[model samples]
Target chain A: MNRQSLKLSMEIARVHLVSKPKQTIVAMLGVTFGIGMFIALVSLMTGLNNFTEELTMTASPDIHIYQEETSSRKSILEEINPDGLNLVYHQKPKNETTKIRNAREIARLINLDARVLGTSPLVSSQVFYNYGPVQLNGTILGVDILDEDKLFDLRSKMKAGRLEDLLSNHNGLIMGKGLAKKLNVALGDRVVVTTPLGTTITLKILGIFQIGIGVVDNVRSYANISTVQTILQKDQSYITDINVKLKDRNLAPLVASELQSKFIYKSEDWQAANATYLTGSMIRNIITYAVSFTLLIVAGFGIYNILNMTIYNKMKDIAILKAMGFAGVDVKNIFMIQSLVIGFLGGIAGLVIGYGLSFLISKAPFNGGDIISLDHFPVNFDPMYYVVGIVFGVSTTAVAGYMPSRKASKVDPIEILRGQ
Target chain B: MEPILTTKGVNKFFYEPEKFQVLKSIDLTVNKGEFLSLVGKSGCGKSTLMYVLSTMDTDYEGELQIAGQRLTGKSQNELAAFRNAHIGFVFQFHYLLPEFSVLQNVMIPALKLNRYSRKEIEERAMTKLKMLGIDEHARKASSKLSGGQQQRVAIARALINDPDIIMGDEPTGNLDSYNTQLVFDIFSELTHTYKQTIIAVTHDDEFANKSDHRVEMSDGRIVKS
Candidate 1:
């Protein structure tokens, strides 16, 4: 209870641990390996998760607003008298425009809201790219190059020319690298495009980009809004889609619902669009924690085993100490201090080793091939993980040491002395 | 001389291996500064009685008092503190912690007592070791010493706290005749020259005959004093 007694207990503990150097180091290594693996696995897994999340999240807007075609199959007879049983055998599909009315006005109004970071209008249509003798299907997206760059950071994804080139040349288009490869076209090369309306035009390639998604990279291309409007033969106000980026992406679902009700259009948030990927992320997180915790607990058991053996070996010492007027608490403290010292030292070593391993992993080469463009493995060096790892390690050892220390304290000196 | 330790109607039982009585209504008293010995055959409860008197065994029925303080019904922690400050013990085996130096082993009880400064405690420990003629080995590990020297170190440890009474459970049981004689002389000097009270349990008749008073026990009861 007093400082002097505690000092004595610590002294005894230090001596005991030092006496059996081999056993002490073995016990410490258990914790060291457990915590080290925990740090490495958690940091790498989280880093990968963040990398994948950014790849998908930044490529698409937080909220997408577009017009959806809907046609009711109800006949005129049913509309006049709903109770009457009226059935139409073969219902004809109704023709409706997929373009949103007043799309520019909606974008401007949505941008005025404090939550909205920016909004970019897009006019996209399916087309066919014609090389000399080869033809491939693709989708052309018409966007204001500067606004698109602000929303999606398009400039960084550019592999060849700049967005400024597309803006300057009216007939210029930026093509995905995969599409460019397929058509055998490079920057400043001319390619023939046939629109869905059978309107053919020759457009010069201004830039080449790669978004890392195979399907998108193989078929998607970018062009100026006016050029796409002229190719589609639509007026200046024609817009098919509005992409909304928010300051806080977490508010996307709520804002999307509000926009849907206000504009009478289909509004989809990124989470809803990528529900499967979110579930996969959650599963990966669960696995990471489960494995890390198992490693730590195994390490804890190692400490427990070593402490128990130490207590068993030192039974005579405990009895003698008790006989010398050392209290039960003092004996317990001596053993407890041994375990804590191991935990503290092992946890520190684990942190250092974990950092070293993470650094190595971050520099390791990664070939994502045509699917994703990455040169090195991802590893996040978050300080919070280190704090959590050490705290968990120490507390685990404490719990593990508790039972053996209690047994040591409860030892009856009389029994031991009598047996001797 | 005034009585320093007294017991009235002390009784103890062992529950394991079926119920059996170990100490039966034991009543004894020892004067201050007296060297007393409890002698009996093996399993006659001399050792059990010693444990009870030393406050290490509290499972007994009767009043036990030492240095005019009733020690019955005291908590284990309180009894441990009392033992640290007031009573010392010398076991049959020289049970020194193998990893600690001779001086640290002697200073353990005094450190637990915490009444004196660390420097003062160290000085007292050194004095006790010198008095026992083991000062040259103070810095050596206790386990590295001979049996006689280790027993002497145990004696020094007992004396470091200046306890009122020193109890021994066959302190010379494992020693040869020469070492046994050395320990006997140490106990005699501790009592006569230092005016320290001592109670030892021994099977050696010669050792018992020379003590100030000898108490004999048979089958858990004191037969004669």
Candidate 2:
């Protein structure tokens, strides 16, 4: 009833658990191994997801404004010139006026919304870089470079020279170190950049950067947006996408809705674009639950075995109980309590071992690289795991204890003495 | 005097497909604090009647009562609870939990009783063990005790719960003469000191003759004493 009796009973159960030391340790080892497997597998999958999400974090918007554009084709070349590559593509350009007007007007529209952290304009174009003999086709980004550090942290990671060279110098550019290396370009080297308008402009590579993003590091070149727009001789209307930032993580959806309504009605929020997170979470949950169910049932088998043996051994004791005016239910409870203790102790062991192993693995060298990702495993053992585990352990033990305890209760002290 | 334990025309039979009558019509009673012995040969239904009075088995056609309650038509749990509150039992084999010490074995019944405090139960168990002169062995495992001493411990354990009636089934059947005599001597002391009703099943006429009253049984029928 109290902790004292519970302690005593647990001590008694402990003795019984270790009575067959080899069996007890072996059984516990099986559970530990199973739980450790759970930890390892879950951590690996979560690590993979986190790594992918980390990659997304590097490239995706602080907040993305989605237009009604289906992003099926990936390669810049394939997306721009679909019919030229044996595919009959007949997609027309979007209404540039509406898109540009909406993106440009959001800066003046909202009345200083607290959740509106920042808004940035983005324009991406496929441009070719010409060096001595290398012609590297790469993404030419026209970033504001104004408070650019807050949005992407890219300028801070400049491998050589100064990031200001791209802004102060009118005809300056910056490419990732790998991209520069591939194009045989270096700091202060002049290169020709062809924009989507088919206008070629000469730019000096004042700096090179490396941020561990293979996709970005190998194929990205950036310049001042106004310089690109002026050099291309476009109009005062050239905002491809407007990236918005929210003050708090929880306010992202609400802010996204407000921004969508206030900025551009057709723009998508972060959650709708990151559907894989929701779906991946559901899949991970299902997997974790299925594994735990299968394993604890196996663990329950051990509990069942222990209780069954205890009940069989204590048949005469149960008969004595009946003779002593203990009802069958009381006798059942004694054994039931014994199993519960076993399950509880074992469950705690499993949880600690499971979560502990996951933590160790999380710190382990499991991730495939050192770029934008982890080397350790990951395990998010939420409250749900504990609730399920304890319930499963206790109920399994109780059910396991049920049969033998009931059998013990049915014993007749008289019949037992008389050998009936 | 109103008997502390009684049975009226008790008839018991074990029936599967074949009906086996273990006890015939029998009437018996023992006054409070009296030591009574039921002496019979093997298969004479002495054990059956003992079980009936101890409330171990309730399926029987008889007016069997212990302490104050009628012992028929009650559920098995009710019978078990009844016995737990009122009856203490000893067997000839000295059926103690070998895993426990002598004191622990004696305290088992009291631990099952919610009414008894742990200190009170231990004190009661010690008192019984001391009276039977096995106090010094209380801490020793029951399995390690000498046979006579072990039987004495068993008697002490049966008396530990302070039941209104103590029933022994062939209490000395498995013991040597020394242990057997030791066991009967404890029963005598139990009756005299605790004013307890003692009913023992025995094959030895001499052992039964020492009781305040003796009933003899033959072929499941109680005939003479």
Candidate 3:
């Protein structure tokens, strides 16, 4: 507890460490490499997880609420025997419907929830697009243009023309780039869409957009809700799906389950739809931590080896220090201080090196394909990883240095002197 | 004057190779300000006796009291504190820490004693070095000094805490005749001028014969005192 003693002990530790330059450098390098890799790999793993989450969020709605599918049954008669004495009738499902009866009221109630950012009612139909001898199958989605734009941030993805054009012109349609290409049409061209219910509607192409995903670009087109409803012979309040965007994307699963439990609707969150990606991120995190911790422990063993050797070489010095009236604990403190010094300097050096590595990797060129959102290798510069590395490094070095320091303290000055 | 250190019926055994007694039962006392020499041929147990008296070797079966305190059966920590406060040791090897400055080496014992602040310890260490005529070399590492100069530094270190007794095991063993005589004169001045007690083990007949008192040992028993 004496400040002078502590200062003297630290001085002794510094002297010993500086005396053996080669061995001390090797021990420090071991720790530096361990901690540096720890920060680098952990940050990269975290960044990849964030990237995956961002992409998943962009490609799916935060929440989707829909009517549960209802099964219909028909009675069919079958022979019971060859003599046909008795006949049996069995009920079998022949139809399924998923149309919400009063979707406008449900949308209104959802909008009243404080957590809801926006909600858009959707009536999607499987249909065929025909333009002068060319035909293709796709989906015709009926949506309120402004509401759908708020839910999907659709205006930013527009390739040509504006999404507002659909609002001004009732018969106007917004088609994906791939769908417009298949019909050999451009903006202001007319195309006929035939629904499965045998309703044909002519829609003028108001805008074209590409979401970068080939499947979505090739098969999706949008029209105003009222026009599609009239053509499909549906009630004004009819809607098959409601897309809900929340203020906090992270709370989507919680709110989805809450809504589902309170109503008869089937609600799904984006996270639930892509659970595998989240689990993959969890597994990556576990692997990163395991590898980093193992390396740090290995670095600790390096410290142990060097310190043990230093104690063995300094036996005479230890005897002399003991003779000078340094207590066992004080002698131990001297060597433990040596390890802590190495840990401290090495931790700092590792953090700097890790930050440099992360920055370099973040700047490295990467040929991003159609799937990923990043132009370069993603790296998260989280401060917590560096903090963790420092704590782990220093503590592991202390534990490793303890055994050798204890040995140094127990050295018999008399025996060493007499042996000489 | 009252005795500064006393040992009664001190016995030591070595279990290595065989159980052999090193120090036989011996009774000894040295008064305050006494300059004493324990002299014997190699393996005559003079060093073992000094070890036991210095409280560095506690395996001996004996009753030991130094500076009016019982030192026998004390823990290693207690013995360390006792040694720091009351007994200082100078070894044959002049075992100064090689990596430290001469002044820092001299200040270590006093720092461990915790009797003074760091600045005060440094000043006391400088005075001890000046007394030994090594003040100019205080800033240099101990290992950079000559064998004789390092021994002088070691002596300065022993005197820093101003203990009741300064014990040396062959204090001039590694030095030439000039340095040996110089060490002898320093010990004489410490005992006569400063009223400090010194107990040194020596093989040199001239060094032993000139001391205030001489205790010669043979086969672990005191032959002459």
Candidate 4:
């Protein structure tokens, strides 16, 4: 209320807070903890998601453009559960009964979409291999040999021979290095693969590849589409969906939707195709939000108690100031200043602590195993987090200190003057 | 000389859900450069009247004026500004902020104006502390000083704003006899040298006798002067 008096009060509070070690610690701890927790939680989720997206999109099309559109992953998950991906990887055998009359024409239509930068006819078959008792059931994706290697890095990794071997011979196959080692097979080794639909195909293992990602390393084999169709008894009318690539990974959704409308077909983004991101993020949010709010509640109580004590301890001083021409408004400002000082210090410390811990967590090996297929956790530091944390810290501390500071302002000077 | 402060029929009642009048329609005028002391034992309305005249409490019935400005119904902020520019107060206990140095404590009042340069406020605070013979304590924490020295710091603070009137409520109440005499001499020299108006409340008769005039109070009313 009083400008000059209020300024004096603020100065008084500022000095008191800085000079006292206990008050300074009590005031800032809440702010620091609130901001720190917010930063750590938000950054951790964002970082991990970016990493997963990078790894997924770099190896595959990141997103695949197909000639049919709906909630593909959700409907598949409901229908098949853990085997949901099986439907996506395996195609119906191309027989006289199974092949549609216009399948190649439909694929040709799909190739003409504006966003379809590259479209390869895919003929996929699930094959089972055996050597004594060692067996591995895998899916072989057959695509245009030259186009597939350039559009998908997963097909380019060949541990034993050139990836171009898939194009060199009519019966050539490029199997996963892990799958080759498991079956005790080598280059030029002749092997018989039986499709799930009871068709047998013969192939010479011309090469092997290790995609570095566990998902592709152990469970996939690649061959040219023409060879797969011929061995599986499929005519030109019979083929799986087209594997489409886009120019920009970020604009995959735009391209997916653009092609969907152009060809009247369905497309799948990686989030929908391999949706661990959405599911994992939902679970992480429930945990982080619940835990951070609980910690802030605890910090609130800490600040409230310290502020209450500050009022009680400084009652005499307040009364004295009131008697000496300082206004009640001025007294209130003193307490506010004290809380502000605490928030300032705690904000700095908490940011330092939170970011430091987050940086360490990112480098730590958290994502692994055949399921994760990643070597490191993602840690991304956005400047916005720091700004939000500081503001959050200051506001929370002020709110926690408001009630007691008001009480201090309402003290009666004469009652204290009489030593009451 | 202009009347630095005036209170006409000033009656102050403390209503804690009941009425108990503290000052009974008191009329008082303090002239510039005059040193006046209110002397009384406990249960006297001396301190209550001091708060009233300082413009800290304007809730009383009656008209009060200071330096040509009406005191009643002015907003809290306006009153605070007026108090900063025109009134300085020294309480019995040296209510110094322990975190600030003696010089900083003195500058607190001057800083409220916001017009003075930092250098100017610093010089003013230093100059007053030196005149009070406590210049050596300018940078020392107020809490570290003896009671007498701290009281001198309080006196220096009151003078920093160059207020029109200074009010002291038993300024030597907590000080020893030696510090009491030192504070009294400072008060005497203040009016004699600088022509500063002083209104002090004291329970000490010797301190009251040294004032230019003494107003004695009893039963929550000023009875004799």
Candidate 5:
């Protein structure tokens, strides 16, 4: 309990561990490997998880507000006649607009909320790309170039030209890499796009980008909002969708519901849109923790076995110490000090090794080949993981060392001295 | 002529083989500076009585007082502290921690007592080792010493804390005649020159006869003193 006895116990523990260098090193190595693997595995797995989540975030908005089509409502004749002959034969459905009314106003109002980050107005249309008799069907999204860039980080994904080019060249279009390849058009080349309403226009290819999703990369392109409006023969107020970004993404659902109720449009959150990806990330996290703990527990068992053996081998020494008036707690502290020293040293070594391995992994070349754009493997270097790793390593060794130390403390000196 | 250790109606039993009594109504008093030997045939309960007197065996029926402190019904930790401060032990096998230097083994009990500074403890340990004539080998591992030298080192360790009483369980059992005589002389010198009280349990007739008081036991009862 006092400082002097603790110092003595530590000294004794040091002698014991030093006397059995082989067993001590072996026990330390178990902890080192367990913690090293834990750090490396967690960093890499979380990095991959972040990458997928980022991809989803870049491809979609935190909340999307759009006009959803509805089925035919009850006829006015049925309301007048009450319960008699409610259905009319061969009734024609009324026409509806695929545009959110007052879209710019809604976007401005949504942006004013403190939780909202930004909003981008978009006009999406189904169109056919025509290049010298090669016709391919695709969807073109017309967006305000600056707002879209701010929302989707589109500037980084550009392969050929900048997003600002779409602003300068009124009729300029930035097509997906796969779409550009299919249409056989390069930058500065013109491609005729035909709208479903039979309106056609020629647009110069200003840039190319890749979204890394095979379907999106093959069938999507972007143009200026005015260009799309001109081709569709609509007026200036022809925004079809409003995409909202939020400061805290977790609030997307709550904000979306509020916006949907307030603006009378269908609002969908990112989590709802990317449920599969969320599930995948959760499962990966669970697997990472499960394997990491298993490794640590196995390492703990190594320490336990070695400490038990050390106690067994030093039975006579323990008996003598007890007879000399070292209390049970003192004997326990001696062995506990050995285990804690091993844990601390091994944990630090493990951190260094883990960092080294992670650095190497981050430098390793990776080729995603058309589906993803990556030059090196992703490895998250979060300091929190190192803290967790070391703490877990030491605590596990402590737990493992406890029982053996207790057994040593309970040794009966009379029995041993009598036997001798 | 002051009584340093006294016991009254002490009774002990062994329950593993069967419920068998080991010590029966033991009543004894050991005076200060007295060199006492407990001698008996094997299983006559001399060693069991020594263990009880040393406060290492507390599962007994009656009162045990050492240096005017009641030792019965006390916790093991308290007893250990008492032993460290008041009673020293020299075992049959000279059970020094093999990994430690001879000096460190000697200094352990004093360090546990923590009544003196580290420098003082070290100096005292060196003086005890010198007294035992093992100071030259004090820095060497205890296991590397010969049996006679190791027994002397154990004796030096027992004297390091300047305990009120020294208890030995066959302290020279494994030694040759020369080492046994050397250990007996050391014990005799400790009690006579330093006024240290000692109780030893042994089978050696010569060792028992030379002590100031020899208590002989038969069938768990003291037959002669």
Candidate 6:
């Protein structure tokens, strides 16, 4: 706590470190390279994680709200398993219907949330597509074309025609590229679409989109909300689902849970629906941190070995210091301060170098076609990664330096002086 | 005058390899400002006794009182603090920190004692250096100085805190005859003029004979006083 003692100790530490140039630099190199690799690897992994998550989120809505489920036949069957006989039973409930009448009101409430980016009410129905000599069963989605484009990135995925055309023509529809190919239809072509309730309507194909998802591209089509509702005999307010997107995709699960509690709706976030993928990412993060810390500790060992050798080499000096009335803690502080200086400098340099490496990798041009639609390699530039790297680097250095300092403090001054 | 240092029935042993008695039932006392020399042949335990008296070796079975404070059974930190404030040491090796400037080396004990500001310690260190004729080399690294000059710097470092007692273990053993005489003159001046008490362990006969009192030891026991 005394300023003069602290200054004296720091001066001694600085002299020792400066006098032994090779050993000091070598010890510093351990931390430098350790933290460098940590920052670099963590940055790349974080970038890859973001790349993958965005790829997944592009096709999926951030939040999905479905018609609420009350205790029905499924719950009854689960409750009465009938003496553990493992019997398979089926029950149909009269109140279990797909249409939610207040879907627009729920969408309005959700859109009021600052976190919500966009929301759309959708009506889904099983439909049949028929040409001159072919018939295929598929699913049709009723949506407002403009809101659907904002929610699903529909504008960028269009391969033929325009999504805006669907707004002007109520009888027009957009089908996936795979569906268009199967029905032998092109833009401006007419197809007879039959609802499962036996209502047949002829609709012109206004747009073709390919999302690269096998199931959706093969069987899903989109029609104007009013047109699909008329064909399915539903009121204008009825909708089967509400698809919601958030300003921050990471807040989806939180917002979903909030909405689920506040309203009579079943809500799901993209992460919950893809639990396996999230778990895989979580495991990868654990592995990255484990490896980073292990490397830092190894670097710490390098410091430990150097400091231990310094203590041995300077045994006479240590003894003399002790004889001059430097306390054991004072001796220890000299070495501890030395290692901390190394850690601080090394961590800073490592972060700078790592950032340079990340920038270089991100800027590298890629001529090969990307299957995930990324034009170049994806790298995240999150500041949190650097903070983590520095914290781990400095602490590891302090811990590693402590062992040698303790040994130095316990050095017998008389024994060493007499030996000389 | 009251005794500045006292040791009652002191005994010491070394446990390395086997049990071996080093110092046996030693009783010694020195008055304030007295110059006393402990002289003996090799393996006579004179250095061991000095270590016990200096409060550095606590393994001995004895009670040591310095400046009227009980030094026996005290913690290492307490002893170190006590040594810093009251005792100075000059060793044969002139163990100054090689990396530091001579002035810095002299100021270390004062700095550790925390009784003065750094600026005040620096001034005190300069005064000590000037007294030893090493003030001109104060800015130079201790290792860069000549052997005789380094020893002078060591002595200056010892005197920086103005200790009550200056303990020396073969303080002039490594010096040439001329430097040894110079060191003996300094010690004589320190005791005669500055009223500094001295206790030294030495194999040098001339050095022992010049002191005010001599205690001779043989086979771990004091034979003559």
Best-to-worst order by lDDT is 1, 5, 3, 6, 4, 2
Residue B182 shift from truth in candidate 1, angstroms: 0.9
In model 1, the runs with Cα more than 4 Å from the true position are A70-93
Kindly list the per-residue Cα lDDT of model 4 for residues A79-140, writing each as its tens digit. Answer: 66774444445433332332323545755775676655666667777778766565568888
| lDDT per residue (tens digit) for residues B1-225 in model 2 | 667877888888888768988888878878899898998778788877887777766688879877778877887766666676688887866777666789988886667665678899889899888888889999998889988888788777777767888888888888888877777787887789778888888888889888898988889898885
DockQ of each: 0.82, 0.50, 0.74, 0.39, 0.86, 0.65
Candidate 3 lDDT at A275 equals 86
lDDT of 3 by residue, B1-225 (tens): 889999999998989999999888989999999999999999999998998898998888979999899999999988888888888788888888888899988988888888888899999999999989999999998889999999999999988888999999999998899999999999999999999999999999999999999999999999999
Local accuracy of candidate 1 as per-residue lDDT tens digits, A106-148: 9999999999999999998999999887779999999998999
* Docking level of model 5: high
On DockQ, the leading prediction is: 5
- Cα error of candidate 4 at position A239, Å: 1.0
Candidate 5 or 4, higher TM-score = 5
Q: Score every model by TM-score.
A: 0.96, 0.81, 0.87, 0.82, 0.95, 0.83
In candidate 5, list every pair of residues with a backbone clash: none
Question: What lDDT, from 0 to 1, does candidate 6 have?
Answer: 0.87
Instruction: List, residue by residue over A249-360, the lDDT tens digit for candidate 3.
Output: 8899899999888766889998887889788988999999999999999999999999998999889989988887888888999999999989888888888888988888
Give the higher-TM-score candidate: 3 or 5.
Answer: 5
What are the candidates' interface root-mean-square deviations?
0.9, 3.2, 1.2, 3.1, 0.8, 1.1
Give per-residue lDDT, candidate 2, residue B210: 87
Clashing pairs in 1: none
Scored by lDDT, model 1 comes in at 0.92
- Candidate 5: segments with Cα more than 4 A from true spot: A70-95, A131-133, A211-215
Model 6, A202-262: lDDT tens digits are 9999999977555677788999899888999888887998899888888988998999888
Q: Give one clash count per candidate, in the order shown.
A: 0, 8, 0, 4, 0, 1
Provide the overall lDDT of each model, using Cα atoms, as 2-decimal numbers.
Answer: 0.92, 0.71, 0.87, 0.76, 0.91, 0.87
Cα lDDT for residue A374, model 5?
Answer: 73
Tell me how far the alpha carbon of residue A201 in candidate 4 is from the true structure, in angstroms, after superposition.
2.9
